[model samples]
Target: QGRGRRRRRVAPLAVSPPPASERGEEPLLRGIFEIGKRSCDVVLSARRLRWSPIVPESPAGGTGREEIIEMKDVFSVKLKRRRFVGQKKGGTLLGITIFKCLHKEENKLTDCAVHLNNLSEDHCNSWFRHLKEILNGFQNRPKSLKVFVNPSSHKREATHVYYEKVAPLFKLADIKTDIIRIFIDFVFCVGGDGSVSEVAHGLLLKAQIDAGKGTDYIPAPVRASVPLGVIPAGEAKQYCYILSVICFKSLWHIL
Candidate 1:
């Protein structure tokens, strides 16, 4: 071994490991880009809401079926309500017995049959007077009266109950009304506060548009102008607080 110059073995160069984030740099960069894009999208959506002009669709007068289809996709979801009409025939044992007795009396006192031989004349006269008054009230109702019904107000069949049970009472009172769906005009809503707010907004927009068109001479429907009669069908009836006209019993009377 020539010991001219002992060259020490060169140590292998130490390689430094990549940083943790650097190892996953591609995914990290993609996530950041996606977040930025979403933020931009949200900002643009907000701007669109502010700048966009809302226009009412032309009234479709042919049949309501087509209009219902057109509006189906516009709202979030259909809210439903349960309603009962005049008491059912066989709901309870007591109800059944009472109905049976009334039915028996009516059958016996038919036009073809003889009047109750035992009852006094004064009793019959008083009953007939009361019946006449009720009939007169129903016969002389306001022609301008119109009823807006929201069948889907509550989770139950409230609309059905109203149509069957409650509506007849109005008719008996001589009020001429058509049980129209609230959606026909945007001025009616089914839920609570949000629903009423939407109706108010629609009315405001309609008023603005009508004014712009110089057709202010024509009056919008009364439902649009007056305070909406709320049925309080949903979880919250907050709008009722604002209007100061929330009444569970009067909902029947409003119709």
Candidate 2:
């Protein structure tokens, strides 16, 4: 009958459920998370932190995980719960600060931040807890860095400067750059007389240590003097002076 036909159509609609979301107990935290300086739509799900182009990389904001920052790859996350308050400037500000050392892409490491904004407290906190727990699992993560500190430089705090100013950028870039005394190649220097001497002396000291351990550092193919390149950043340049005078040519000038 006519009543039976109405029931069949109604049944199909009921079976469809909510096609968009899967009975979300809470809403998903999805917004733009800045791919470069430009804003893009990012989704924070239970599994992964994913982003897709809102600026139209293809049709209809594309689809699927075109760019994804896996939860496992996330290293350090600093959650910011501050909102710039005032009548002039007021919003429910939530930020998920991600300092990530991403998994290797083409056998290379990448580090970056997933900067997010305009999220509810529930969404932010949920993502925070999830992210924190995942990051905790990586406490025993392996790391490598090569740190060169000029002790007698102008500020006499080159190491401190590296720790403060430079290291944060390295962390953001997902680049490992903070282990001490770890260069086997030509040790390049760019400070005053102390710097040049320190590097040259350090290499010899390292060589001496290696030699004492019965390890021949100067192997068959690699010669005694490895090439060192320096682009000077200071006024007093003893390394460059020595190189130019002796025809060693530490600095390369392009014609």
Candidate 3:
């Protein structure tokens, strides 16, 4: 007893809530789930998902601590379940798993996951359907992307970077990707200046061809149907860095 010391329990930190207008009128669904090893009261709204830890009532009442995740940050949701060894048939329902994009240093975005563990299959399925519908309603999100990787860029590390770091996130988000197909909801490139230039040129060329014109078409080349995104893996990353700054600045203003 003389050498041992008692550990003090720290109060949970409270996070600021989203604006009322952003959350809309009412929650789409409400349920009890285990999050972060704590039993939480979860609420899913049109624009965000919120959760608060459940604690016994004290004389001081609640601490008003809650966590909120904006729907715009969420990329995918999947039903969680448990399957025993060699059990391919229907598994026991666990709950729902949400994959979201988290902002990190140097204008980077990475995947983060939150698991809502509940054993009730019916309850979980209801929440899953609502979450899926909400996600599908985001028309700005692309379902498929055409990827172009320059294996020669940066000592031939571009391919490795794309496969190792980028492809897993895309797969987790349930996005379909094709390297050589013409049909695409978006265009993604991983390389340096040369690769970026080639992809841009090729998109414009394809647009012109789709408009029944050739490469020499001068009267304002048709615009590409999908947008292009770049991942800098080459020596010349200054342009990409600058673009990221501008984009984040705009987002900051919007927020």
- Model 3 lDDT tens row, 167-195: 88888778998864233455677777788
Give one clash count per candidate, in the order shown: 13, 3, 0
Q: What tens-digit string does per-residue lDDT give for candidate 1 at 153-198? A: 4433568878877665444434567667763322235677777677
Q: Residue by residue across 1-255, what tens digits does model 2's lDDT show? A: 566565434445445565454442232465555555556677665447777656566666564446766666666776655555554454455666877675578787857666765356776677678666656556466555677775533234556777787788667535577566333444456666566666666555544543343344443322224445454555777665666543245444211
lDDT of 3 at 183: 35
lDDT scores for all predictions? 0.37, 0.58, 0.80
Q: Is 2 or 3 the stronger prediction by lDDT?
A: 3
TM per candidate comes to 0.22, 0.38, 0.59
Top TM-score: which candidate number? Answer: 3
Candidate 3: segments with Cα more than 4 A from true spot: 1-25, 59-64, 85-89, 181-255
Alpha carbon RMSD to native, model 2: 17.1
Ranking under TM-score, best-scoring first? 3, 2, 1
- Choose the strongest candidate by lDDT: 3
